[model samples]
Target: MIIKVENLTKVFKSYQRGNTFGEAVKSLFVRKPIYVHALKGISFNIEEGELVGFLGPNGAGKSTTLKILTGIMHPSGGKAEIMGYTPWKDRKKYVAKIGAVFGQKSQLLWDIPPVDAFYLNKAIYSIPERSFKKTLHKMVELLGVEELIKKPTRQLSLGERMKCEFIMAMLHKPKIVFLDEPTIGLDVIAKDKIREFILEMNRNGVTFILTTHDLDDIAHLAQRVIVVNHGEIVFDDSLTTLRNYLGVKKIISVSTMRPLPELRLPGIKITNRISDYKAELELDLSKYELNKFIALVNKSSTIMDLSVQDPEIEEVIKGLYH
Candidate 1:
């Protein structure tokens, strides 16, 4: 395994004051801080060259786990080893072998062009000139950001800056990269571009650990997903397995050639009716097979078109929380 964690945990201390002034004053001098267990003995491992999605709702300790793995924070308990190095204990050497990108943070100098930051990263990492040039060229080409590299960071669009961020993180060619919400605020086109670049990099043998609220990213990039809730590993399995486990229900949208007099079927509920000719129905797959349902529909109505869709990834994840 390229990454290993066992019984990893982190606790945070926070203080809360009373509503009354007198109570607040008294509590300030003699109050116990609240302890929040951000991570609760979560354990998992990732092999080399694998792309995995680390998913959870807000405050579920996803960021804490990423920070610990990237050497930014220490776990209060448990052990984690990446590329044979303990992250917090060996921060300096460990960082050199890995890369990280947090969406809300900026590693590039605000006033400087990305090209300048790239050069600075080269010096900081002590990357040989030949390797730096080759990597930079490939990154720029793959990202289609050759023209944006020379623009000041502030002048660039969110998508442009994000592409530069990826380049900076990958210039040294680290074995593992941690990306937290890499496409948080980009439009659909920009999101697709970023996903494409990530797929390309993974194909070329770079390991990626991605955390995002966007399920599209997971569907497109991850072969495996590890879902956490309330600081615990609630689900850890391949994407296909996840779908199968949660795929007892399905949505089918049908469009008929003409309006029908009446429509009824067992184990199917019409969720929406767009006129008499078009309707969306929810199917209970456990009670009815898909083929049989389709046959019934075709026999009853003149079908113009139909599409069967699995439940949305968000709903499947939301189910984990309950």
Candidate 2:
């Protein structure tokens, strides 16, 4: 097994609804410890070389779970093993076999060239000189960060720095990689670069456990998605399964030659109506008869243009939480 987590739990002491002054006072005296069950007995097994997306909203224990897996934090209960090593035990040795890139945090020296940080990691990880050169060359070429690597991290743009970050993470060619919001602030091209790099690495037999707020990232890359909510695993399945469970609700926009009245149509939500010339409709695919809906709209006026799309993955996730 590449990763085996059984009944894993991480509890953090935090304050929840500290209401009364007397209650606060008592909390100070008795120290009312609120247990944040970050991972409530989460159990899953990731096979070798699989790329999986770990998804959750803010404070949903996604980061907490990753910290435990990477040996950055200790689990409060249960067990976790990555590549036959208990993540929290012998952390140094375990981590040497894994690479991590956390979007919110920077591991490179701000004022120095990115190559400096890359070399530092090379020395720290004790990579062989030949292997180091080979991997670094491949990463720089693949990520297209060769030009950016020579510049100080602080001088580079967000996207440029992100590319360097990715190269640094993979320089040692570790077997497993943990990426947290790898494309968080990147532009379209930068995001594409990171996505391509990830796919390339996975193709070369490296396992990846990714955490991100970008649903597009999950939709495009991950075949299997593990969704956590309120510190619990709410869903773990393929994107198709999740979409099927959510049902396919398509948004259709119709443009007419002239304006029309607000017509009450069955199984069609008139999300917006701008004069009689333009209207937007949110249609529930399961409920709406596709041809019937189309016919109804066609009868209204001469159709200028129309386009349809299912509700986005982000909308589906938000609905689940709500």
Candidate 3:
């Protein structure tokens, strides 16, 4: 395994004070402490060269786990081993074998050109000149950001800046990479380009752990997914398994010559009613027969058109969140 985490846990201490002025003033002298359990003994293993998606709603311990694994913050309990090294204990040596890119955080100085920041990373990592230049050129070329590197950071667009951010994190070509929302806000074209770049790099044997709210990213890049909620890992399986998490559920859109009947039936939910004659429903095959429902709908409304599709992936994820 490239990464193994056993019973990982984190707790944060914070002060709580009442809203009243008296309580606020009293809180300063006699503070009430609240312990927040951000992680509750989550465990998982990741093999080398596997692209996994680490996902969760906000405040669901996703960030906390990432911090511990990256060695920036110490966990309250449990153990994690990445490539046979304890992240928090092996500090300097561990970091050299891994890279991270936080979408909200910038590694490059705002006023300086990205190339200058690249040089700074080169010095910090002590990479050989020839290898540094070769890697930089390859990434820049793959991302089509050759000329953008010379422009000031502030001058680059969000997409442009993100491309440079990837280069900054990969200068040393670490074995593993941690990406947090790498495509937060971007046009469709830019998102596609970024996805392609990540796939190409993964093809070269770079393991990626991506945490993003974008389901598109998860669907396109991840072979495996790990979902956390309420400070615990609720689901960890292949993307296919996640899609089938709720069992056999399908979406059905129907248009008929007459108004539809009240879908007051088991295993069927009216998801959308565009009009009296046009409606969309979700059918759970496990509870109700598809042929029977079709016959009923056809008899009542004289079906003009009907289409069936798999439920959106979001439906599966939302089910897990609840």
Candidate 4:
């Protein structure tokens, strides 16, 4: 196993004050304690070269878990062992074997060129000159950011800067990378480039742990998923299992040569009626077979066009949350 976490826990202590100004003034002397349990003994393991996604609603302890694993915060209880090292206890040594990219945070110096920041990381990690240049050029080519690296970081677009961020994290060739909302803001093209980089890296034996609200990222990049909610593990399984968690279902979008009939058949739920000739519906494959449904539509309306796809990942996650 590359990562092993057992009964990890975190408790934060805060104070509660009053609403009124007079009460607030007096509350400075007397305050009620509020203990927030951010993590409640969560446990899971990850194997090397596995790309896993961490998902949860807001205030679901996902960030807390990542912080503890990255050695930024000491846990209140339980244990996390990454590559056989306790992250908080062996931070200096442990961090060398890992890399992280947070969408809201920047590691690049704002005023200087990204190459300078890359060199700084190279120095901090004590990467050899030959190896550093070798890795840098390879990533620059892969991301097609060779032109942007020499320019001031602040001048680059969000998508451009994000590409540099990936290069910075990978320079040291860490075994595992932690990504939090890595594709938070970007167009279709940028998202695809970054995803391609992640896949290429993973194929070469690098492990990745991703946390994001963008289910598209999870769908495109992750092989397995671990969902945390209410400071606990609610679901952990393969992406295939997650898609089928509710049941075997497919979204059917069909347009008929003529008008579409009222789809009141068993196991059929009309989600959207585009027009008299077009309609979209959900198919409960467990209750109704695909062949029968297609045949029925063909005979009645003379199907002009059709599409079948898995249920949205959002639906599966939303069900778990509620």
Candidate 5:
């Protein structure tokens, strides 16, 4: 395993305000700090060159776990190792071999163009001149941001800045990269571009751990998903396994050539009726075969158009939380 975590946990101390003014005034002189268990001993492993999605609802220990793994914060307890290094204990040396990008944060100089920042990173990481040029050239081409790199950071759009952020993070060629909400505010085109770059990079053997609330990102980029809730790991498996485990279902919409009568079948739900000739039905595959159900429907009506769709990825993730 390139990354291994055993019983990792993190705790934080915070203070709660008094409910009433009188109590608040009295408590000021005798403030009591409350402890929050941000991470409750979560553990998982990732092999080299694997792309994994880290998912959770808000305040579910997702960010806490990432912070601990990246050495930005220390855990209250447990062990974590990435590439044979203890993140917090060997901070400087460990960071040299890893890269991270938080959607709300930036590593580039706000006043300078991204190319200048890249050079600064090259110097900081001690990257050779030849290696730096080769890597930068590839990244620039992959992202198609040659012009944007020359623009000042403050002037670039959100999507443009994000693309540059990826360049800065990968300039050093870190073994593992941690991305938090990398596509948070991007449009369809921008999101597709970023997703493509991620796929390309993964194919070239850079391991990635992505944390995002965007289910589409998981559907498009991650083969494996680890779901966290209330400071614990709730689900960890391949996307296919998750769909199967959740008892895969599909929504089928049909348009008939003639007026159709109300049809009823076991495990089939009539969701909507656009007209006498058009209707939508939900089919539970675990209860019955889709083809069997469709054939039965076809016998009764002349099917003009039909479409089948798997449950949305958002629905699947929401099911995990429930």
Candidate 6:
């Protein structure tokens, strides 16, 4: 196993004012704070080279778990080990072998060119000149950011800056990568590029634990997903298993060769009727397989266009929480 998390928990103390004036005055003398359980006994294992999705809704402790795993923060209780090292206790040594790109935070020097930050990383990671150059070249190429490298970080667009961030994170050739909402603000084209780069890295045996709200990213990248909700692991399984667990709903959109009257199938619910010849239906996939469902649709009218949409991963996670 590359990662072992056993009943991990983290508590944060929060203070509030006393309701009554007397109580508030007393609290001014001797204050008491409340404790928030950010992580409520989360436990899971990740094998080497496995790409997993760390999923949860906002305030669901997803970031807390990642911080603990990446050595950015300590857990209040239980155990977490990465690559045989306790993350928080041995952070200096542990972090050297792991790379992280926090979407909410930028690691680049804002006023300097990205290349300068690359050298800073080389010094920080103690990379040999030859190795640093080699890795830097490869990362820039893989991320398609060779031109962006020479540009000042502050001047670059959000998508360009993100690409540079990825290159810098990977410059040291870390064995594991923790990406938090990597594509959060990227447009569709930029998001696709980042997704491609991540898949390429995973193919080269760099394990990934990605946290993102982008269901498309999860659908296209991670084969396994671990969903956390209310500070607990609500689900953990392969993507296919998750789809089945949620009873994956399929959207069938049809464009008829000619106008057709209103219709309904037993397992299909009409979501929208775009035109006389076009209609969209949401089908619960558990009840009807794709081929069978399509065959049934074709029986009613001559089909011109049709597409089967799988349930988005966001919808699956949402189902778990709400």
Best by TM-score: 4
Model 3 Cα lDDT, one tens digit per residue, 96-167: 989999999999899999999999999999999999999999999999998999999999999999999999
Residue 282, candidate 4: alpha-carbon lDDT = 98
- TM-scores for all candidates: the values are 0.94, 0.91, 0.94, 0.96, 0.95, 0.89
| Candidate 6 residue-wise lDDT, 1-322, digit = tens | 9999999999999877789999889988887789888899989999988999988888899999999998889899999889989999999999999999999899999999999998999999999999999888888887788888898898999999999989989988899999999998899999989999999999999999999888888988998999988899999999888877867688788898767556555667888988888988888766667788666557767778998877666676778887
Q: Clash pairs of candidate 6?
A: none
What is candidate 5's lDDT per residue for 78-180, written digit by digit as tens? 9999999999999999999999888899888899999999999999999999999999999999999989999999899889999999999999999999999
lDDT of 5 at 84: 96
Q: Choose 2 or 3, whichever is better by lDDT.
A: 3
Q: Please write out the lDDT profile of model 2 over residues 1-322, one tens digit for every residue.
A: 8899999988888765458988777777576558777778899999998999998889999999999999999989999888999989979899999999999899889999999999999999998999999988988998887788998889999988888888888888889999999899889988988898899889999999999999989987897999899878888988887776677788888888766546676667888886668888788777887777777667867678889877778877876676
lDDT of 1 by residue, 282-316 (tens): 89898788998877777778788999998888878
The per-residue C-alpha lDDT of model 6 at residue 307 equals: 87
Local accuracy by lDDT, each model? 0.91, 0.86, 0.94, 0.95, 0.91, 0.88
Count clashes in each candidate, considering only residues at least 3 apart in sequence or on different chains: 0, 2, 0, 0, 0, 0
How well does candidate 1 score on lDDT at residue 34?
96
Superposing all C-alpha atoms, what RMSD in Å does each candidate have to the true structure?
Answer: 1.9, 2.4, 1.8, 1.4, 1.6, 2.9
Highest lDDT, which number?
Answer: 4
| Candidate 2 TM-score, C-alpha based | 0.91
Clashes of 1: 0
Error of 6 at 295 (Å): 5.7
| Candidate 1 positional error at 196, Å | 1.2
